[model samples]
Target: MTDQLPPQPTTPPPPAEPPAEPLVAPTAELAKRQLTPLAAGVLGLAIGAAVVGGAWLVTATTGPSEPATFTLKGTFALTDSVYTDPGDDSCRGSADSGYDDIAEGTSVTVYGAEGDVIATGSLGQSNSDETGTACTYKIAVPDVPSGEKFYKVEVSHRGTVQLTAEEAENGELAASLG
Candidate 1:
């Protein structure tokens, strides 16, 4: 008999690797989180109301504060026959006579309903009508307060002309001295 070969040693297989971790957590580990549709709508409405109420409060507190003011504009007409300049396009008045108040730089005053002076201005240069029989001076009194029931405007020492606040707002005031 042939000599028996030496018994070969057998090698065991390598051990298997452990499984990898999952990307998402298992359902048992996560808690449920959600809002009902009615609750969501009520929250949105509350936020909207807060914003609107805040805006209204700010507007009411800060103003409608400053009283309104306006310019009082009109004309002062002089019809004295003695002051007419027939040869020239302009009219002339004397400081010594009745027409003195119609001269340039005369003070124009605006009074409120309480008879207090509200504004003051001066007459501009004199302009003559086509016939030179009438002289008109422009009156521009600025910063006259509004909201008065009425106004009284005076040029120099001449009488005051009463005007409703609505009429004065039209800016068509006029005063005359002959």
Candidate 2:
């Protein structure tokens, strides 16, 4: 038998490509479009200055924190709770039967970092009905130094009392005096 060769396979030609152009425009056009050396230097300086100045401004606002203050929570005894009659000089309207009870005035002395007395304040008054426990007062001491943790609190009415260390750690001093 006569052997016949296999038929030849057909192949397609490659596609044509578009003409290539220069990556950049003409030098004259590029020169017109681009910044000069002096211009570039000034622009770079301005940008750098703007970045630095912006950083400085941001840090200035958030830096150098103000000093810390403290609030003391404690109870004060009410030696007298009788409200003086504003309209007429008389003592009859007493909430507790015939006696009124309110917290008396209190003062505190706070020492500074140098062991000198830095701040002193008188606590506000609290009304009482001559019953229950003593009245509670929130003693505020402002403008304490940043480095000072404890202020050596001395209450006028309660003598000496120990406040919670946690409260002192969080810039607050709290105590209860009967």
Candidate 3:
């Protein structure tokens, strides 16, 4: 029997509760936690300075911005090739007009026949002011070789010159052949 059912109220369920708001830090607390403007600025400056200095150091130490290349250009024969110190195995040779393009503070090594380091010296300045164009390298050569000693010059910053009979025959002591 279709008994009169109690009035069934078709009401939509209550709307779902909205998600709770996340608990954000209080403004005062956030302000205290963050770095101050002055502090942040200082930190940025320090970081920038460090980067610049590091780059400069790397370039200065590792980069190859050589000033010049020395060349022995002239007609001069090496006659007296002896060591600055006779006791020492260093050798020294004289050329007429040679040319060399040596940096201010580089060192050069001269090798004699059989690959013996006959002389070594720093590219020193000629004048007291350290601004002269010409540099005389008083090298200490190793004891002269036995025969037809072939000599060669090398540097950490520039070119190498293999002592030759014809080229060493005559010329100006090259500014490069320091």
Candidate 4:
């Protein structure tokens, strides 16, 4: 058997295609514009202004803030009847007499809801005694923060005097305070 090779025919190539339009239009003017430092800064400022303006507009549409006020026209007083023991060097170690002399001008403080010092006043000499006798302290807590739904009144004497919730809420000054 003889193996014979067959001749292949050559065909002409297809025509060249026309070039398609560019995806993006060429901006020769923009390409030529070199951003100076000053121009770049101005552009940045304009963009920043737009962002800030948008934020301001959003907040303005949200409306006003809530009111934070409390009605506190009343006066509160503090009274203590505590005595101080004077240590003695004598046989029984009992001293003469000692009084819890809460100073006449001792400062009083009222705490608010957040434990902030909301109001301050003094326990007057006319109200308390240096001789250890039970006395009434009148304090004009001009105003109490609405935040402080309740109040805790504190005074410093020979020791600290703090009024309980029951005492602070009492409208009657003398009995509740004392």
The candidate maximizing TM-score is 1
Q: Worst 10-residue stretch by lDDT in candidate 1? A: 81-90
State the lDDT of candidate 3 residue by residue for 22-114, as single tens digits: 699678878789788999999999999999999999989999753422333322112222123234332233233332233334566656556
lDDT of 4 by residue, 1-178 (tens): 5587676668777879989978876799569878999999999999999999999999998979654543222333333444333452111111233323343455667775556787777655343345544344445555444444566556653323344444454433332344
For all predicted structures, in order, the TM-scores are 0.59, 0.39, 0.27, 0.36
* lDDT score of residue 30 within candidate 1: 65
lDDT of 2 by residue, 1-178 (tens): 6598788768867778977988988888877887889999999999999999999999999998767654544434333334544453322224663333223345676665455766677655443434422344556665544456445666663444433434544645655443
Which model scores highest in lDDT? 1
C-alpha-based local distance difference test score of model 3: 0.47
3 against 4, candidate with superior lDDT: 4
In order, candidate lDDTs are: 0.82, 0.55, 0.47, 0.51
* TM-score, candidate number 4: 0.36
Between which residue pairs do clashes occur in model 1?
A: none
Query: Would you list the rank order by TM-score, best first?
Result: 1, 2, 4, 3
The model with the greater TM-score, 2 or 4, is 2
| Residue-wise C-alpha lDDT for candidate 1, range 1-178, written one tens digit per residue | 7799988869877878978889997786665645689998999899999999999999999867877899888888888753654565556565667665567788888899999999999987778887667888888888899999999998888889999998888888887878
